[model samples]
Target: MQDAAEPPPLRSRRDLVKELSLGMVAFGADARNLTSQGNLTPAQTRRLLPAGLVAAIGGELVASMAYLAMGRWAYASAALVRQLVEVEYLAWAVTNDPDDAWEWLKSDRQTRLQRWQPGKIRQRSDGRFPNSDYHAHCEAGGHPVPEPAMNILDHRDQWVELSLYEAAVHGTATWHYLVQAVGDAPVTAAERHHRLIDEAHNVWRRTETLDRGFLSPANGSDA
Candidate 1:
């Protein structure tokens, strides 16, 4: 018999996107089942928080996937900011008194209280404040924190740790991707595509792990 032919190399960008999509679908089904099992009523505001967060995270992942597929790498990174926010919210729910967390969520003033003050504090005209510090909150809860691509908050040289999400949200450094060049070096379309795909895969994997942890029996979910 003739030897079997070698299989073609998998396309990293396409395969990763497909895999991420599948993971989102599975998570959605599991989330729905968990919500149904709880039989949560509108009045059960505390219990509703987890379900709502789960849905929100899933939606954020979908948005990220869409952006990645469309070659909007910066916007895709921006979409992940919500995932990080939701994960921290989940950590709060699992580690603290659910009632207290729920109360904080409801209060605009309380939620706006700044948890981190770096350097000289400047008052905001918009009256917005930074939320909980991501690393501290996750660490306090004994939950795994997703590895940050950049430390935009505490770094001495802000530009040294500029994150894609920050760039996309603020329109700073977005020209790097828009012009297909970084600093003095040119980034080919293929290189940029693969790089963002790898980054997205990492984010998805970490976020999924956090999601499962929140839904695990020890965290109080039936999942």
Candidate 2:
């Protein structure tokens, strides 16, 4: 049976993190707040995270946040798409079961996420940095992965959800990246960005098509 009480709406990133963090705190999970620490600083995380797998997943999240904030919808979606694949890598770290790890993609994220454990927070290896870096602070340091992170990596029908990000959002976010690639020079920038975005769209669509061929139909999605 599910909890009948509704949780409060998570309209901001801070809210989401706070909600997740509360549970982990009781376990003596990393105590430093992400905002207080370096939240999405990949350069810092890469060096600090003990496991390469954690670094990779954390890097993808950083890329997603960076691209999305810049209005690069396709790139943002791309980052998220990669996370779907990378979750398998993370799972392999935990279970060492290739078959089970691969299933992380087809797994229903919403259902699995409901089982998410509280996220860990750790003190920095050095005091020079005021706060803990999210990835390095994990219990594994760089080895085993947590079940919650595995669940968080799964995408809920990401094939369709990604399409919405690529197509349904009016391409405004897509345009943001394109504009920066070219400049305020007008025609050149417009043409350059358009071509770049179109190229990215085609690549993502093609990849999705290829991935569809491998999905297990038992997951309820049609082949």
Number of the top-ranking candidate, with lDDT as the measure: 1
lDDT of 1 by residue, 1-223 (tens): 2223422212222344443334333433443454566654543435344434443354345445445435534323433444444443333332234454355446465354552121111122122213333223233222433332222122312211112222122121111122221112222332334455456455433332122222223333223
Off by over 4 Å in 1: 1-45, 69-72, 75-86, 89-96, 114-223
Report the error of model 1 at residue 123, Å. Answer: 22
Which one is best on TM-score?
1
| Collision count for each candidate, in order | 0, 3
- For each candidate, the alpha-carbon lDDT, in order, equals 0.34, 0.29
lDDT of 2: 0.29
What local lDDT score does residue 10 receive in model 1, on the 0 to 100 scale?
Answer: 21
lDDT of 1 at 208: 28
Task: Tell me which residue pairs clash in candidate 2.
Answer: 30-121, 50-142, 51-142
Candidate 2, residues 1-223, lDDT tens digits: the string is: 2233423211222222222122112111121222136663543232222122332343344334334534534323433433332332342222232232223324486733542221210121123211221232231112244542342235434322332332212132223322232222222323433454454444343333222211224322223
Clashing pairs in 1: none
As for model 1, its CA RMSD to the true structure in angstroms is 18.2
